[model samples]
Target: MKAVASDSAIVLVVDDSPESLGMLNIALNNAGLMVLVALNGAQALSIIERITPDVVLLDGIMPEMDGFDTCRAIKQKLPNIPVIFMTGLTDSEYVIKGFEVGGVDYVTKPIVPDEVLARIRVHTQNAKLTQSAQAALDYAGQYVFCVSNDGALEWATPHVHELVDSLNGDAPCAWEQIQQLLAPWLAQGDQSQPLELTNFEPPLQAYFAGEHGSNHLLVRLVTPKKTKTAEALQQELPLTKREAQVLYWVSFGKTNWEVAQILDMSPRTVNKHLEQVFKKMGVDNRTAAAAISIRILESDEEAVG
Candidate 1:
């Protein structure tokens, strides 16, 4: 799901009054938003359980469960869902209470359709952008996470959690220990110097990528890939130093252009080195030569282990 919100821009409109629902449904639908209707808080929660809406337009006062209680419950289940309260309750306390219960915005009764639509558009667009960012991170196979200002884990990708497990070593940090480990680094704000967690073998480097939003501090985990030294590869294989370096990156599936950037050489020079690597290793193609490199690397790792 990439967290929350769908591409269709689904908006769940919850209100005890049929009048409000119909009016907003027409307005939202006319604006090209798919609207889901709910008669009360229970109905709203039920709808949310089945499908995540882009923004929840909830009535503030309803029978059984008021919008405040409903907002609290909704936040508990899906904190990413933005709830906006709409009711006749226009008092200062009501407005303040709405936000305290997780309402992102509040609109009083007799609300203009245009005003409500404007608010929904803003929240819905924000939610979609967030989903896109999370999906992009997953697509790139990145170990990244976002933490609250208090250093609590807000949201993270699966790979980031795996990195955290490795950083925990034998004792899993769970949550508290994780907060302690990350809190200090949050304050350090040093982007150039990577935060080192040396408790585990090979260790890990935490690079702060800066803030994602107002409260989320973005972090990326850097881990060393299994690679052999170019010198060691040259000595082990029937190839020169340049050929070894070329083959080393190529074995990891790097293109000739990419390998040239890493090795600080021209693309033509990289292709030339690759040709030498193939000839020396008695292989007709790069794939066959890569097989030889992988064998050498695996053997080296096995010996070290």
Candidate 2:
């Protein structure tokens, strides 16, 4: 049987029984989702390692490893991937165990094809949004510097501002000033660190900088680079800590009031921060702001790669 083609979602079906596997494959494929089947947990794990499916429909009973253990292992290995249990075991205790194993949902056997397809659609959509939000969060913590062909700073994340201030007594200068201030450091080759210069400054002064695309732009991150906390913070973009929080919600497509609820603030406060974000980003609306943020994030990933 052939399923419809939905380029956006990939579903992995794990069941030991050939009949059950075939049934799911037909159903999922008909619904326009790409489907992959594994007869057991071991095979499922191998498939997962090779291809990160949007969602996994796992059977509770399997040889070598049962669904719960498999689900736990998958979550540990790939925390972001969502798993849904598809099983004949409908006991409440079994359901609870599935949840404990990190299963996002449960569907009993003798499955209604429509219901299964609907649930898959819902979970896949949620997963896509969650991934996007996490990407945005990572983008917010990192340093992003776009340089012109002349080696001037076109733009820098706010964290770069902090780094510049620490490097020079009269810091927080415009992008042009930053280029001049860090000229020596920028001259360093790919493999070198600015240890000698940083040693003269505070010990906490550290940076991870890299060049991308024909050396047109240089991206730099400065912090106590060795610390775990600093690394985590560095993965985020250059937003005020609060703005980072707000941007997370924005990436999830939340309204101002919804964001306020999540942040435990009033809608007015959320709007105020949003306005500041707009002004700083030089974007007029939320859609434009989100697009710009995503672009900055994608660029950061390219620089890292």
RMSD of 1: 14.8
Off by over 4 Å in 1: 1-7, 133-296, 299-305
Please report, as a residue range, the 10-residue window in candidate 1 with the lowest summed lDDT.
296-305
lDDT of 1 by residue, 1-305 (tens): 22243345778888999988888989888988888999988898888788777789889889999889999988988887789889897789989999899888988889798998889888877875676476547534667777776677767777666655655464355446656777887777665777765555556566777766445677776654455676767888888778888899998999989999999999999999888887777889988988877887866342110
Best by TM-score: 1
Model 2 RMSD in Å is 23.5
Model 1, position 200, has a per-residue lDDT of: 50
Best by lDDT: 1
- TM-score of every model versus the real structure: 0.48, 0.47
lDDT for each of the candidates? 0.77, 0.69
